[model samples]
Target: MTETRKTVWGVLSTANIAVNQVIPALQKSERLVVGAIASRDEDRATAVARRLGIARAYGDYDALLDDPEIDIVYNPLPNHLHVPWTLRALEAGKHVLCEKPLALSAAEATTLIETSKRTGKNVREAFMIRDHPQWLRARELVQGGALGEVRAIHVSFCYDNRDPANVRNQLDIGGGALFDIGCYAVAVGRFIFACEPERVVAEVDRDPDFGTDRLTSAIMVFPGGRRLVFTCATQLVRSQDVQIIGTTGRVSIAVPFNQSPDREARLLMDDGTVLKGGDPAVETFGPVDQYLLQAEAFSELCVSGSVDPYGLQDAVRNMSVIDALWSSEETRGWADVRQD
Candidate 1:
């Protein structure tokens, strides 16, 4: 019998997502291990490493990238630092699983694509929802025509966060409802629609104090006249819901994003048979950690030297849609989405 070697991952920062969600999930994977962690503040990094059982802690990010023992680097840093650091990690000869919205703009994201090609290292934007079973099943239903002639998707995601010191509230570093949560809407729409939108129009409300977008609503028109309507907010009651509407039926995701790993996830399918308050057919998925699934998938790519189906190009496309939305907000009219 041969012993399989696990891929070692070094984390770039003790970001909350990395420490509280991603690192814990990576630790649960059989094929991946958290080798080290780094933060500008050495004490904070050391404390996190101690708490998380990570073997090494570096005071600076470049030091961790310099370590040869690390097979991959998981970057959960803030939005502005995403591209620069991910590029550095690739230049240092390590694959990177970067946090979502890979860059502040489509132009910025192209650098990661270029660097990844130059370095022969795989880099993936960490949109964990793409790996969850429920989302997969949802995509399956869409492809299989479960909801006949699917024409539209409606999404509502919101949460209230007003802390002046919080990173999400900061303006200069890509902090806004659109970049924070609205990008999920764009990604999932592309995933389910299986194509990019033709044009988008948006309305935004910026916070008076923080200067970040607190609320955003956008409509995307896809090929075949299909549409996606979504709203995301950083200063509203917490909620999330997604509905796929079709000519003959509807599919509603009960917990679309931020699904609990310990509870069963569900979907409701309506065929229009019960018009008077009857129950829709329910599809349930057992508890599973999406973050763990995402880590393991990225690890496989790390070992195989293969490209992710939703790799840099897909991220660029997603960012392009977001860019169009921002453009629409500025122009107060429909803006064409850049496909390339």
Candidate 2:
């Protein structure tokens, strides 16, 4: 019997997402092992390591990267820091899973792609929602004719955050609704439609005090003339959902963006069922920890050297849409997404 070697992972920050979602997931994955965690303060790193049962703790990010034993690193740093850390990890001959909005714009994402190629290591932007079975099921339903010729996608993700100091509400560290939640909106639309948007239009409102964008709404026209509209906000009632409206029927997901582990998720499609005597076709998925599944999937890629679905190229596409949206905001009109 061949002994399976686990992919050893180090974490680059004590960010809440890393601690709450990712670390727990890594701890639970069969193919991955938690090697260490890093913080600027040695005591803080040591405390987090002890609390999370990580084997080692380093006082600085480079210490873990400098370690020859770690195979990969999970970087849940500030949005602006994501690309730099991932580049460093790749240069060290380690794979990277960096939290999304992989980079500030398409240009940086392209740089990441080049860095990955030069370093001979891979970096996958961590968009955990893409790994969720719910999304997979949605893609299946959309492409399988459950919804005939999807014409429009609507995604809404928002949360009310009045805190001035939170990174999402700050201007310097790349804080805003578009970067915070719109990434998911754009990603899910692209994944379901399997196409790129040709043009984009966007509206954004800035916070008076912080100069951070409080709300962002955008529309993208995709190949085959399909369309996606998504709105995200930093100060709004919490809501998350996605709908794929088609020519024949429409599929709707109840909890689309933020996959809460406490509740069951459902996908429903009505195909002239209400007018007729038939009930709507429905499927419900039991609770799943998407981050855990993401860890397992990424670990599998690291171990097998298989290509990641959301590698730097995919990240670049997503960022390009974001860039187009920002451009539209400036022009208050349509902006073209660069065709390849």
Candidate 3:
């Protein structure tokens, strides 16, 4: 028997995520290998490449894209740079797996959808949560009638970050609580409900100095009256939780967005029989790295041309809800999500 050839992946930058999480995960996957890394500074790129055991380091992004051995590009660039760089990677004949909140808005994301079709290369937003077993079980319980008709989901995610130079504090470059952390709240709602929200309303609190949203809360109305209410903040105690409510039961995720890769993940399901659901059943999943799963899955997609159906199109849908949320803040009223 012969071993199958693993896909080669070029990382776009030495951004924190690429260095601290995604690069390590990609190196761990049997289906993928880190072929190269790039940065505006060649020395920085070379240092990261050497530290991560990558073979090549490019002084510029296009150099990595020009590498014929590179079959895929993992882009963890800033929010504003997602679309342009992803488009460049696609044109360079490499599949792309970009970071979450794939674009600043729905219309910007659609360009990737069109470019993917035109270039015949795949592009996927890196929503790694969808690949986690715990989240998978959560979706199964909801769809399998365990949750009885899931009615609503509530999410709260926040952290403390006041650095003036941090990308999350820059407004013109798409920095805010909504773009940085709130996107998970929006994406998970669509992931669980398996449909787009019809409309949304939101309230935002901007930092007086940074001019970026320090806190944001929103409500999304899905079909059949299902809804998602969420609040995300960047200047508060670090915390995250999710609860899925239904007619008969509910599921609570203590750490929904940033589950530690080394520890087991557990979810609580309650039938409302126990007082305050004190004795809810616990479903546990052994340790797993979702980023690794994401890399392997995309590698499979690249090798076989299997469509994820929920690739770039789903990204546009997620961005639509986000777009509506921003619009709601301005109008101080509900804004219909743009479906087209």
Candidate 4:
């Protein structure tokens, strides 16, 4: 007997992320089927659905959410809309795989988590870097003491998104360099360091025309004196890299920061040894594959009743760090990360 496919997914936006990444990933995953695409504009929805070969198209998000056949919902909506639509999806009896920064603030993230628990549904943030094999290997190596007690982590993610009308330039819709790119740096720091920072200090740069931050630099100090210094920007030449230093040696992840990085990451030891590897074929890298992995993982949770690896708790914690960073900038002093 042939094994049955595991999941059917609905996409809630016609955002570029869906068109470029998530749709292709769903098409590639053996465990998932692309069910439908939804956009606020009927014509755009139909066009994206037809172009992507998705079977169903909905003119509105709720119509797609109401479809019982859609087992998982991929939400790549704007940052401000994440909590509202994710909650709506859960209430509609659909599991949600929302893009990162989970919400504009930690309080919003907490509300979503509480609602997920109340509804007994799976809700996860889409932090695709965690699913990458190289990062997985890095985590294993670090956890196993290959680097001899991690002392510090340095990461940077930057790109030029200076378009006046780009969503990242819009303040009210939750557009800012910190929310867009800083979340990745923060997530990576927390993931590798194995704890959220006790305090955050940050500086932000705002463009005159946009009235939103275009660049940010932050320092996170974790317990045991480990430090993660990170920078994110929307007005710089593209660069993405991470370095972890320990007592015995160091590991460098070349271009580890991008939505799609083509170079193999490098690992170096104090003994003059170097290790190099490329992206895993088992997963797709960049915005699209990341969303797909999130979809597949949520499907597995629904089918098997397993704990979500990147669950609501993780989302809340990440948002809390973000909130603290913003607070640090506001007061020009270290802000303690608030936890609930």
Give all TM-scores, in the order shown. Answer: 0.98, 0.95, 0.97, 0.91
Candidate 3: stretches off by over 4 Å? 1-3, 274-277
Clashing pairs in 4: 21-288, 22-288, 259-286
Among residues 3 or more apart in sequence or in different chains, the pairs in candidate 3 whose N, CA or C atoms overlap within 3 Å are none
Cand. 2 Cα-lDDT: 0.87
| Candidate 2 lDDT, 1-340, residue by residue in tens | 0127888889998998888888887787777789999999899999999998999999999999999889888989999999888889989988898898899989988888777888767788888878887789889888898778889999989999989879998788899999989888888878998888899999999999988889999899998889999999999999887888998998888888677766787887787676678787888888888888888887787777777777888889989999999999999999998764
Backbone collisions counted per model: 0, 0, 0, 3
In candidate 3, what are the lDDT values of residues 159-186, reduced to their tens digit?
9999989999999888999999999999
Give the winner by TM-score: 1
Give one digit per residue, the lDDT tens place, for model 1 in 203-224.
Answer: 9999999999999999999999
Error of 4 at 3 (Å): 8.8
lDDT of each: 0.92, 0.87, 0.91, 0.82
RMSD of each: 1.6, 2.0, 1.7, 4.2
- TM-score, prediction 4: 0.91
